[model samples]
Target chain A: MSAALLSAEALRIGYRGTSMLPELSFAVAPGTVISIVGHNGSGKSTLLKTILGLTPKLGGEIRIRRDARLGYVPQRETMDPIYPVTVGELVETGRYGIRGVGRRLTPPDRARVREMLEATGTARLERRLFRTLSGGEQQRALLARALCAEPSVLVLDEPTASMDEKGAHEAMGLTLALARKHGAAIVMVNHFIDLVAEVSDQVIHLDRDHQRVTIGPPAEVLKGRGSQGRYSS
Target chain B: MSEKLALFAASWELWRGAVAAGVVAGAVCGFVGIYVVLHRIVFVSAAMSQVSSLGVMLAFWLVQAQAIETAHHSEDILPLLFAALFTGVFSAAMAGHASARLSDRTKSSEAFIGSVYLLSSAALVLVGDQVTRGAHDVANILFGNTVIVDLPHLLLFAGVSLPIAVLHVWLRKDLLFVSFDPVMATTLGYPVTWLRVLLLVSLGMVISIGTRTIGALPVFSFSVLPPIAALALFENLRSSFWASAVIGALSAFLGYVTSFLLGLPTGASMAATAGVFLLVAKGLQRLRD
Candidate 1:
């Protein structure tokens, strides 16, 4: 069996020195999808942020495979829409880690950006201002930005929040396809149980009532004896 | 009109210094203003300008207390140097305040910025009163007397601003990334905190030198309005940058000419011209929308 791309052992997540969720332990292997589902303020997004190292972990350890790259799709609401960046320019920022500082994008970088845009169905909106795009379009553009980096670990925060049913389906499908193609470990914070069960191999439910995390395969976690009943579609 | 034109031409040598100062101030502010606007730190810039002006006034007070015959030594740049130093100190403080985990504080960063602006303004007035001998200099510091800008002053402004501008252009992408999304920039291994501090330091240096050369109001206006106008007019960051510089340079030249022709204050005229550009650009944006 392949080694886990990302593993968190008894990880505690929070903000400003306060813990928000119970300790979580999980391991994500390549080409596998892990969904973090919880109620509002259940620290679902905080877990993702902790994994990306945006927020400091309150306790425990997170280990990523050596030389593993991380791609992040932050919540759309967190980004200010007033910035004057085009879809193409926004996506190109994903190359910053790959290209390093003070280096201009090469032709291959541009080609990859274009390919990602096309794959995410945002090629037509490449020249459009990021602020001007609709919610669905913006999500897809953000996904393209994340995918363009070719990360070994892709972490998305509510990738389909505020998206229509069809848009969410398409976005999830595209995400899964990219994960399979790259054999990347995919971790996402999702609220929709049906969508979570459809795409994720494992579901880590942050049961706010019990203040504990339950992690297992989707079938067992969603329908088995440990099922919380709050995740019904 | 011909007489006015001939008058401008006749004293072209004297006007040259003022024109150079205006152009440099406008260009530098235009370039740095993009970060100011994108990072949403206009209030910080405003407060810093006030603090810088207060520094100049304090320098004058100190020089006067020691009975230094500043009138005989009009060539002295000690005050400007002191102003820059004070501005740097204040900028460091502000940066520290911003970076502090202020979850326990009731007042936000805006409140701190507002308090700084008010306190600095009051301190400038108090210092200006104590240093009555430097009253003319105080007036010059408050509202710029750009017509009296000499070659040495213009050179001093250029010496500080030019290299900062080049460095900003060289690191424009990193700067923009850090400004636009600091968290993501950090995730990508960029030094977000250091970059933010660097940006504030550069802003402080510009305001320090600019307030001494062109006065506080004009420096603040130049550092704010042009980027706003450019952002309104252009959809792309590169276009916005270029357009902002052009607009700043043009506004400076035209405002100087207008001030000279109308017998108005040069700095206020320049600031007013920038405001007009902002309004026009905002109108154009509305029409497009």
Candidate 2:
């Protein structure tokens, strides 16, 4: 089998000396979209944070297969509104990792930013300050920022949690398009069941007890456990 | 008439130093102020300025008078440098240690900075009382005499301010990232804590050197008001930086002109000009809003 693009082995997460989630293992394959579905307090957010190395892990090892560039959009509510940056500036900042310091962006970096902005439907809003945008607009702008980096694996934490229904659908469509068009590995922590069922290629349901219940396809995942109902429901 | 011209020429020479000081001070303040305002570290700036006063007083307490003719400028500056380096490092270290240990549970950082500020100011007063022969010289250091900003001080200001200006320009985007979203900065692999520490040290040096022309009191305005004024009008990072420079330079020029015309205190007049600029900028921003 081809090597996974991004893989985590025996990951353990915690806060204040207490383990919130037990040792877990997962891998994200290139061009695949994996949606992590779980109830509240199921350590979904912790899992994402651990993958990004935001907090010190209790125990685990994560390896990126191809020295893959990583991009992430944090939860909407966690972003500060007081940040004084326009969408274009925010998107262009993604090039920081690529360009390093004392070097101006070449034609390619500039083109990448523009293309990402266009793809994310934020081309017209590029000049607008981030905090002034509506929730959905800000979310799209952040995605544009991520895409500017040309990330191999794009991870998002509840991108749709604060958005309205229409916004949620639009965001999911954009995310799926990014995965398809760029061959990016997409991992998202999602609370909504219907949305994941509609878009995800693979569904992994997490339990409060930190057990992984691998649900095969949208048809099987949407069906409630022990229910005799058909997939049409 | 030629006497008036001579006075004008002398005053013009003084004006050059004042303008130079203002530009260097303004540039340093603008760079440091962006992060200061972004991080909500106004108290840190205040602590730094207060601690800087102790540096001056300690210099006076340490330096001794020598023969009048051979008064080397370096001899005078040596103690000030030592005092500045010592007090600045000490206060910053204390604040860092206290914040790391006690800030999570109790409001230790604020308390620590406040206590240091008070202690430094009290120490300055006691040192002033004890050192009588250099009372006027101490006052000059406190509220600098711009009329006499010599070559050595000018070189010193440039030495400290130029590196800060270059770093700010080079790291403009990175600094902007940390200023905007520190969490995002970290995830993107920028070291946030180290950047902050570097900023603190650079800010201390900037204010220490700038204390010569603008004096201790006006240095606060030179550090804060220009950035505030720039933010009032501009939206982009580059534009904001340019606007801040213009505001800072204009305030300094106008302040010098005001003092020259009315025989007012130069430092206070400069600060008043910056304050008025801030008010006008605020009013315009309100109109736009």
Candidate 3:
């Protein structure tokens, strides 16, 4: 496989010193997609937080290429709408990650912000208040914000959890095209098993009750573990 | 109106330092208040102000007990140092454990803040009673209606506030990002913890000096009211920062002038002026809706 952008070896994840799942090993190469699929009680969020360095790792090691930058797309509902930010301004903040503090975002940065919004099909809504957008639009805007950072690895948390069927598929398609176009690795946490099977290059299936983590191709995982009711809702 | 203006101008030499102090302190508090209001930690401001008041009382008590005679009211700044130290420690605690985190919300945590407020309020009175010059002096400084501003305090207020204002500007986006989306800020490699500590430390300094200069009522008002007034009218947060600063400076200056004219208390007058602006802003917001 190509040089991995992110890899975890015998990674133990949980709160404090306790392990939530069996030790796992995986590597995500550039220009590929890996999905962490689990139900509500599973430790997918803990795992994601550990990877993002928001939470401390319990044991083992997670490595990333030295030059890699991680772009995060948070869930739409997680962002409070009370802030008076335009969609354009919301996307503009993504450049803050790239530009750091104090330094202004150059013209190229502004152009890139506009470009990402256009790519996500939210360009026309740039002037509108971000809070006024529907849930699906907010999700797309978040995606645009993540891409605006031009990260080497893009982490999306429940990217399609709030979208309708059509919007969800459209978002997945965009994710694939953009991943290939930018050569960025995609690590997504998703509850929808069917969608994960279709879009992911590798799937990590999590079972909370049994403290199980199954990692394999989507077809083998789905057939062996049976498709979860993620989309049945 | 002209007569009042003329009276104020005649006393300009006496009042110039105070008016300057008001404007500088008002601008800093107003600007930082944006984060204070947005992050919903106005309680932190209130608690810090009370704690600083306690510090002021402690300074006056110590001077009286030791019979320390200071030149040109050097005793006044003794209170300032005491206040800064007290409030600095309080703000550090707030920033480290809860206030700066912004997202940390729990009843027990709020209870801790509320306890600080009550204890400081009670302690200021107790400490004041021990000052031989009369608690009235300490009370006057802590919550009085009028201000007799002098050169040294004015210079001190400006010296501290001006740098903080510049720091806020230089670090505006970083502060805004943390206040708005701290988790994302953390993921993007920004020093979220240090930024938060810096924010609260800056806030503590402003509140301590502003309380020493204009009294707690106006300081608290300046730190909260203007940002709220700005938020009600502006659809953009950055625009609100500018508006809040303008409103804060205006309210402070107007309150000082009007207090001198109408024989009212300066701190309350300033607070009332800001309150009036808040009412107008809310009215305008309703109309817009």
Candidate 4:
């Protein structure tokens, strides 16, 4: 019965002594996609990091209902290929909340992992080493990992930054499907305006220099900003 | 002929304890090595081992000096355990601090580890001056001591290594996620700090327990070589763990057996054997390409 799936009231985020954005507020509703666009180092990633609890919120409060769970995909560059984890095991981590601590993954959890992997079109790579996968494959594997959590909210930071045009389109399609099919609130920070405009219902812009949050429809927010439209240099 | 047989027999009796140490050492090294290779912190493993040796040597010197006046029973063992524990805990803390303080500027894991190793080496030699005659044995301990493993030490090694193996298995997924992308793992709510601490502490325990039997130098070899071998051969986390464990145990067994026959140092021999496998595995990989 809440209007917001997740809400940040006057949130402040950044490293100590060098905060990027000013006091910010935003609300994400169920089954909606919000694309956060900003220039590099504009606290876009910082905002996502703070919201997902990767970093501390410098001020204000972040509130999530006890029943809510989150699945997150970090920037493509953030993941290194040295580790020898399989896609299946990576996805299985999403089900950590389903079972009790110290307990092994149940059959249901395993099935869910398989289901998510298949749904994300990464079934054949389930046994493949995560390090050996291509960039798009890695993104799909991460998506499978996120979906396995059965989360109420999905947060992705530049999920398709390194993908080909086709891969980017597929990623957007899958992301939109994830939100629509699961009724999950999707908060994604991306640089591609045209791709986001195709899938996202709303857009939020973090103006690092001006220190403000600009939220509106994708066309309206991106209209006057041209070339530098939100993510332009 | 009988003299040769008697020497062989004497060594075989020593083999009982050495063999157990070999198994424990292999398992611990292989398990901890995964993290070292993944995180590029192999030097931390080496430094921790040296620091541990320094602690043991210091404790031995204190006990020996005290025993000159009055024979110390619990006093020797207690100080040794205390020294190892202190070094393990402190080294981990120092490494953590260095890593955090220099995250964006530069990684300080190596610098911190080197400083700690140097400090420990100085402390060890300075304190070990008390036992002039036993310096040879102490030196061997720094390298390793397959010729003189006792039952209690073997049991201690097993007790420590087994729990670490189990912990690694239980936390397999989270460890994989953290190793792959700590940023994302943290966002997904994995306790990255505590996980790293757990890994470091387990590695410390392994290093401390195997200090005498596997020797500090070769103990780290097990940690580094086996994981690399596993990485080359396997793709999955569980597969890597199993493969590393198997290869580690095999190398230990082969090392001890070959040393028994050829009169080589077991620790060095085991490390050499593991290294050879790594070469062959890498060579095979090159051939495929």
Best by the TM-score measure: 3
Interface RMSD of each: 2.6, 3.7, 2.3, 3.3
What does candidate 1's lDDT look like per residue over B1-289, in tens digits? 6788789889989898888888888888998899899878899998888888888887777777875556655525777777788888877877666555222234377877888889999999998999866677777778776576788888989999988998889889988987777667766777766777788898899889899998887888888999999999988899888888778877788888888888998889999999999999999999998
User: Alpha-carbon error at B13 in model 4, in Å?
Assistant: 2.0
Poorest stretch of ten by lDDT in candidate 1 chain B:
B98-107
Instruction: Please report how far candidate 1 places residue B164 from its true position, in Å.
Output: 1.2
lDDT of 4 at B237: 62
TM-score of each: 0.92, 0.84, 0.93, 0.90
Clashing pairs in 4: B144-B215
CA lDDT, every prediction?
0.82, 0.71, 0.84, 0.75
Worst 10 residues of 4 chain B by lDDT: B98-107
Kindly list the per-residue Cα lDDT of model 3 for residues A25-46, writing each as its tens digit.
Answer: 8998888889998777588878
- What is the C-alpha lDDT profile of model 4 across B152-236, one tens digit per residue? 7677678767888888888766665556666655555666667767777777877876775568767878888988988787666
lDDT of 4 by residue, A19-124 (tens): 7778877778778889998888788877887788766778988887667888887665666667766777677777765663356898888898888888889999
Each predicted complex: what DockQ?
0.47, 0.27, 0.60, 0.47
Docking class of 4: acceptable
Error of 2 at A200 (Å): 3.7
Q: Say which prediction, candidate 2 or candidate 4, comes out ahead on TM-score.
A: 4
Off by over 4 Å in 4: A164-166, A227-233, B1-11, B64-71, B91-107, B129-133
